[model samples]
Target: MTYYRTYENKEDVVIQFLKTRTDRLLKQFDEGNYQNRYEWYKEIFEEILEQKEITYKILKTPQLCAVALEHFNNFAKVLLPRVYKIEGDSTAMHNRIIYQTGGFVFLMSHWVLDGCRQSPEEMAHLLDGYIHNQ
Candidate 1:
């Protein structure tokens, strides 16, 4: 309510809150020492698993989906090229990134909304396979 008062409306409050959370996660990823993208993603999923309830709420909210997608897009753009050499046309590379990121977001949203039954390690492994199999 206080944030709603400060912001324009509930959606603005939600967007602000999501951005803050996403930014913090991204910052942590940047700071943490990881051997590979798998380790980086594992740490990320672990953090989200720690806040499953709040994460679920955020994912379930339709208005906030684009914000979440944007964060994933930004994360993918940085992380993917390091993991795989995506060569050829710039537009092709962009589309590939978008495709991979969208799949990741879809998997994450489903996992979180489905009570996050799999452990973070498991989710990371699954994501690893998904990325490598492409």
Candidate 2:
């Protein structure tokens, strides 16, 4: 199936997909198997915002969340391929990431942005460097 670009409502879709994906990814990460990766992402995620509360940001966090959502859906352009199992598909990125049998795990979380810090491809490159221990 071809992944169509719904540029208008893409971010909302991606946010929904990511929120859902994060829930499941947390489980895998909590387990012993992906602990390293999980911790690594958590560290990055925490470090990125310094554990600041999104609510206090006065729309910043929510705006970032919204931006992140859009980024994810736009990223679905190539992401749909790396994804192992896509039970749901949409212009929103809410249901995007699922740690299935194969594919790069970082790609999933990298897209889980708080705002437009970086592009998915850029994040993928960074993950590649990290995964290879460069």
| Candidate 2 local Cα displacement, residue 64, angstroms | 10
Question: What are the per-model numbers of colliding residue pairs?
Answer: 0, 13
* Candidate-wise lDDT, in order: 0.76, 0.44
User: Can you give the TM-score per candidate against the true fold?
Assistant: 0.76, 0.26
Candidate 2 structure quality by residue, lDDT tens digits, 26-120: 44444544334434445434433442343224233566555664444454443444333444455443433432212333343334434536644
Error of 1 at 17 (Å): 3.1
For candidate 2, the lDDT comes to 0.44
> Tens digit of lDDT per residue, candidate 1, span 1-134?
77656998656766676667667756766675777768877877887788788778778777766666776687678656645656554887788899998888889889998988999999999988898893
**Residue 22, candidate 1: alpha-carbon lDDT:** 65
> Cα lDDT for residue 75, model 1?
68
lDDT of 2 at 34: 38
Instruction: Estimate the lDDT of model 1.
Output: 0.76
